[model samples]
Target: MRRTPADVWLALPQPFLASEALAAGRTYDQLRAACHRGDLTKLAPALYAVHREWADLTPAEAHRALCRAAVSSLDQVALSHLSAAVFLGLPHPAGRLGKVSLTALRSTRTSYPDDWRRVLQADMPESHLTSHDGMQVTEGSRTVVDCFRQLRLRHALAIADAAAGRGLTTPVALQAMRQFQAGWPGVLSAERGIPLVDGLRESWLESASVAVAHELGYPLPASQVWIHAPDGELVGRVDVLWFEWGVVGEADGMAKYLGAYDDDPSPTAAGQRVLLERNRERRLEGLGFAVARWGAADLRGGGDGLARHVQEARRRARPEQIRCLWRQDLKDPLQEWVWPPPTRA
Candidate 1:
């Protein structure tokens, strides 16, 4: 009943310590040989994962794996900041994952590798800690606030919006959390950004779109607004809506359209979806709503690109031309799609 390296790797929890394998009757030489043979991939010092699992992961997943490995190796460390955001599944600005973030009480002297970034604080509130998939993580509200304090305004708002939209926290709660950290270095920035968090946003792109709109000084638009045709049929739900301005803003992601029809992946299918989207835009135009669409490019362009799109929408808007209903008389079409969807007690 001698287990092979693959069997040992499969049997142990992922991102495990070398000592665990040794304890299970696996020799140190065997572990070294497995790593040398590509059966086990060294994540950090002493932490290993099956080579196949490590190689097949997306960048985000790989980053999480590193975070998990870091958590497993460190003692009295609770994941915080961007690392906590990742664990909580909140959206964050793109950044390198070369370092893992952890928080510990100022009194605790915990040594970690150079790759670990430790944030020591005098107050280690119990309420702010929670267990996520067996790892200690800073709670969502605290994580969002920490992000707002640590990241740039745009980056922080993206995280806040994602957290709120996903029902992890609310603007009010985040604001209240900031009250205690008044003398903190980045409190003002967090205060200014908290009001921008909107829970209705369904995707990170939509949140980024809103952040860009805010940078352009545009008024906050209703999110997830329903648009109806003259015949009372649902046209679609717009990402951002400005009723008085007669403009509808869509944060377009190509992935949303592709594979939408019959799960097709060919170029022809993609072209067909594009044509259908164009026709849908035409219908919106006919109803007197100025349609403003921005894709990943505009998002990558930063605030300037978003401002340009908003200016175009403003130019095209004709409030007098609007004939479509903003709200439906029937039950909310997207009630079920709401985040933290209703649960039976």
Candidate 2:
């Protein structure tokens, strides 16, 4: 049977089990064969679906398919972490497929046999548990906390950003929740990841910019800022802007420039592009903004390099430089601007 676009759209970026596909009036063997022949993708054992031809599959679809498979398999596990973030309508990076993270109480031993991982939460609170679309998962707050414990700070920040953006977790509430979990790791994780959620960035670059700055004692900027032209057309916002230093920092990861070349040839064109950014930089510089460009090497490398870069930009900076940069240009005046450079001298 030909499933509707909606049905098929709901079963990607994660696998579906055979029996469930059969119940949906789709032949499992047919889909399996397509995956075997490279016509489709097998997200897990006996789970099959047509691959998305354009963009990556949606998170809801991934969760739906995984939940369906778990239910059909009669498994006790439920989606969690990045997968759960997707299910909860929180944005996450689609590339990492280390696991279709699942959480279950009392630990079950079923295995996917391919492209799946099972995570056990031995103490998942029963009251904070629920089933959605056939899979079991911890409630929003619990899921957010669990992910913070397991994933990297950036990934955790992504989950928290999504959660907070949707009002699922507020700083005050989360901070209060931390009091319930005692011990070293719990305390450390809470200390590190909580305040970051108040204003999380949409992209990994922005998140990294936030973290690195915080780590290096440089005040983090308002990420993904929107700078508009006088006519109201959006120009562009720097990835990171120090409103107090008149310094605009961007994480110029290789992907940014390389992605443009891959997406279209025009961005790499001689006069068509190189000149475009040059003009953009000139306009920003003319506004008394000093733009500092950092790449993936600096971000992924570590603190010393990034610290030096930010420090050099702040050395000898005046309030007027930042004052005009924010007030006249970006329209945001930062109050945290320290005077006398904090006297390291």
Candidate 3:
């Protein structure tokens, strides 16, 4: 039995290729009719997608679709910058970013870059190249440092911390790349943001929040510290610990507590998660630490938004009451976990 356009459209992937559709039993006339009827949107020469589904995607998702198109269109090109970050699974700030990005040993078209793609001209070493699925891509550390040089401080730190946190790369390697690429466009921003990365941060939200804290000139806090009761009972592992100030800053994402409440996103599940958090806060406060939580709204507020919430906790915390119950495995941030060979690594 032959498949019709409707059948093939649903069967094919989002942002699929003209050839993919034709291969999947769509005739040339049907592909054109679909395009004419607004059933498909052309992303590039041969790349296309279901129009309605494409419209519903967020910026990041849309970019991933574009990256996939680039993967299909180019032959032997290394995906670079944010496009490389996408394939590497590194987190980036939310927003519409520019064209699909790639790297070539040298530019193929001397006249112009493709309307939808940015091809970086470079002679990057083989060591700095890797692959995603089958498409050539810059390696993790190289991708990250590339982004750091291209993006601003807030966006760069999030990517850097995520790369470090996941064991994909180390701050030391990032710094070395910055020095090697010195005087290249935007290298100074990379150099500045590289020092602020802490691999212990578990999420992009936590990393970005700390980046803002740096700009606000707030005291830098310890990342991922464990607090124990004097009796040796583990109270909790915290996101950010101002050890001396007795402050515990928690970066609460929208879904942090939802999954544990049975993956049920109902109001009841939300309430249960809040109850559990409240209970945890009471216990941490019992240990003389004032616990504060910040969310995306706080980060979005800008100015003194997240800062106010954490600083308020600081006001309530008693440094004199701070105790040795919190056991921090990494006392020094610059121990540079991935560089020094983790005792366990």
Best by TM-score: 3
Cα lDDT tens digits, model 1, 1-345, are 333648768787676777777777788777778888888988766778898877787666767877776776656778888888887787765645546678874447555565445545535588888899988888878888888888866667777877786778876778778886788877787887787787777676787788767766777777887778766777777788765577789888767677743568788988887898898889888877789988757866556666778779889878675766545224744221122223321
* Model 3 agreement with the true structure over 43-120: per-residue lDDT tens digits: 777778888888999888888778877767666677889888876778877888778888875546421566788877
Candidates 1 and 2 compared: the better one by lDDT is 1
For model 3, which pairs clash?
none
Can you write out model 2's per-residue Cα lDDT over 117-217, one digit (the tens) per residue? 65545455676566665456656676677667767666677677667766777777666656655552555775677777744455656665576667666
Q: What overall lDDT goes with each candidate model?
A: 0.74, 0.59, 0.76
Please give the range of 10 consecutive residues that has the lowest summed lDDT in model 3: 336-345
Error of 2 at 344 (Å): 20
Model 3 TM-score is: 0.84
Tally clashing residue pairs in candidate 1. Answer: 0
